[model samples]
Structures are given as structure tokens and as C-alpha cells.
Target: MSAAAQRVDTGRAAHGALARQLRLARQGRSMLFPFIGRSRRFEIWAHYPRHDAVDSSGRWQFYFHVHDRAEKDSARHPQEHGHIHLFRRSPQGKLTHFAGLALDARGLPLCWFATNQWVTGERWADAASLVRELAHFELRLRGPLSGAGLWLGDMVRFYATPLRQMLEQRDAALERHCRRHDQTRAQAWADRRVAVWSSLPVNWPQDALSAAGPLTQ
Candidate 1:
């Protein structure tokens, strides 16, 4: 098969896998809230429900949290339950930002997006490089939330094209921002207003679920 075919295959496989992960978790009655834990539910200014929880292997790391409700910004970032920031580190390596996905109260994905360097405090990776990594992601996380981990990484492939589009747009947004201020690319990458860039409305898993599932436990 050609490389293009291979990428399509990988993306199709990832979509199916992610959808199944959600289904199984729903069957287990764990769904989405389990990761948040009960203790930190309403704590203000907290990383939600707590900190960046890493998988047992310490490779896949993520956290779900929200901005201060009073904090105003673009309408694109409407206040929601919160958003989860995703990251991955290969064996014996350090974590790199994956992308951010916003979730609604029903636990459905609302959008796929990115933020400024200041937002995630994550190591920088350019668009082309990140796009190359997207289709190759195959996270085999351990234990009960194992599927969730795989789902997170695979979701990138499942949404590979848009993910790449997001990366390109992120860079473009930064470029336009830097041009506007006559700042270098590196300087504009840190701009707060240009922080959230490259977003697309949520799609996929819901369609997959409809075709292959009944989401209730």
C-alpha cells in the first residue's frame, strides 16, 4: 500500500479504537468524570479537578481544568465545564504538548485547539513536525484508563487532517500576530491575545458512535 493509503488506514483505525474506548468506558459506568475525581470538583483556580496526572508509565500526561469564569477573552473560548490539555513523552523522554480538546457537560468534544507557550508551559514543537507525529501516535497506556490513553493519542490520528490544519493555522496565527506587532516569530508565540489558535468544531466520535454504538452503560 502507498503511504497515503497507510495514513488513511491509520486514521480509520484510530477513529474506531477511540470510539470503542468511549463505549467501553461508558459501559463500565466510568465515562468521563472518573478522571476528575470527586475531591477537587469545584475548587476555584485549581487544575481540575487537580494536577497533570501522568499514566503509570509516566509517558502520557494530561489534566482537565477551567479558566476563571470572570476572565474575558475571545468568544471562541466560551466558558464550559473545562478543557483537557494532552501531552505525550516517549520512553525515557520528556513530555511534549499534543493539543487541547474542549468538552461540554455531556462529555462530548466541542472543539480541537491550541494555546500560547504561556498557557500550557509545554516545550515548543513546530507545525510540520507535530503533523508528522500525529498519524504515528499509538499510546498503549496501562490499567483501567488504558483505553482512555489510547483514545487520546489515537484521537489525533482519527482527526489527523484537522489536527494538522490546526497546527498550520496555529503557526499562521502566530505569524500574522508577529507581523502586526513587528515582533519576531519567537516573540509573538508568547502573545496572550494570539494564544488560542487553530480550532475546528468537534466531529468524528459522535458520528462513529452513532454508526457503531449506544453510548449508555
Candidate 2:
């Protein structure tokens, strides 16, 4: 892995950014307002931003969307409004999903998760490769969503450790499923029953405040 991939950040920046956005949301301008503003009626399974939020470098991208009711893991995240799926794009345009950040109605993150290949139909990559790509995650946008982009990037750094563990757990789960079912890795990857490979909940409001530290100072 590259040195950049090993870089991590305190969540202060993310917490401050989110605090600002939340204040705005209370006044009717949400971080999600940019993407959902034009939709007459936002529908489930429809990815906000249409094409997606590609970073300035075009190598990183993400989009927010809600899954169909049946696909939601309400047992784990009852308040999940949706999730932001992050992807790493190759120069040749092959896209690899690295992680997903589930958020509640107020746009606060609820958890980070890893999914199977069939979930995103992405160019499957190992946890180590995905971890290496983490240092390269960036999304510099200029608009109402600019701060939102920065917050998203900060989130990757904030939860880097858990994200790494989740990815590793995902891989391990896949291996276990393959062995238990006597199926090849490829077959296990395509198994519809195994959608979410791993997930870890975020302890919200309290955790966010703690990570933010003394923002006023």
C-alpha cells in the first residue's frame, strides 16, 4: 500500500462541516438539497445527482440513493434514509465500489458497510487494494454540495480504521460462504442471498460531538 493510503485524519473537520450543514438544514437547505431539489418527487432506488458526484480528478465518485424497502436492513439501521456509495474509477473507466456510508433522515451518517460484487456489479477488488485507494479519495465540487463533498471525504478519513476492518470482514465472509456452500469465489460473489458482506454502526450524535472537539476554539 502507498503512504497516502495509510494517512488518517481526526474527525474534527468532518464534524464541523456536518454541524454547519445541519444548521442549514434546519433553515430548509439540507446538504441533500442540491441533488433532490429538482426532483418533483424523489423516488427510491433512483440515484441522486443522476450521473454522480465525480471528483475534480474524475478518479473518485459517489452518489446517494435509497434502496427498495425490501432491501433495507432495518434491523441494524432503522433510521437509515439512504446511503452514499463511493467508487474508484480507473483511467480506463472501470469502476470499483470501495465503501458505502449510510445516513439517516437528517443526513448524519449511521454506518459504513461493504457489499458483495453483485450488489454494485463493480469490478471487484480485494480489501487491501481498496484500502490503498482510500488515500486517493477526493471530491472537490463547486456548488451547494461542495461542503457536502468535503464532508464525505472527511468521513472516509474519520472512519478509515472501521472501513478497513469492514472490507477485511467482507472478504472473510465471502471466503466462508464459498467454503460452506462448496462454491467457487465467483459463485459466491454472484450469490443473491449475500448482499451486505459486512457492516458497522456509527454511534451518532454523541460520537460526532466527541470527534468534533472544541470547534469554537
Which candidate number maximizes lDDT?
Answer: 2
RMSD of each: 3.8, 3.2
Instruction: Show model 2 residue runs off by greater than 4 Å.
Output: 1-8, 70-76
lDDT of 2 at 129: 88
**Residue-by-residue lDDT tens digits, candidate 2, 71-137:** 7453346778888888988888888988888888777778888888888999999999888765555
Cα error, residue 203 of model 1, in Å, equals 3.0
Whole-model lDDT, model 2? 0.77
Q: Which segments of candidate 1 are over 4 A away from where they belong?
A: 1-30, 38-41, 48-51, 55-59, 90-95, 204-206, 209-217
Query: Model 1, range 1-217, lDDT digits (tens) per residue?
Result: 4777866655465556556655755566333554554554466556643655676756667767766667776734563557778876667666667788877655566788887776766677788877776656666655545666666665666677778888899889888877888998667767666667677777646644543344342
Check candidate 1 and list the clashing pairs. none
Q: Rate the local accuracy (lDDT) of all candidates.
A: 0.66, 0.77
Question: Which pairs clash in model 2?
Answer: none
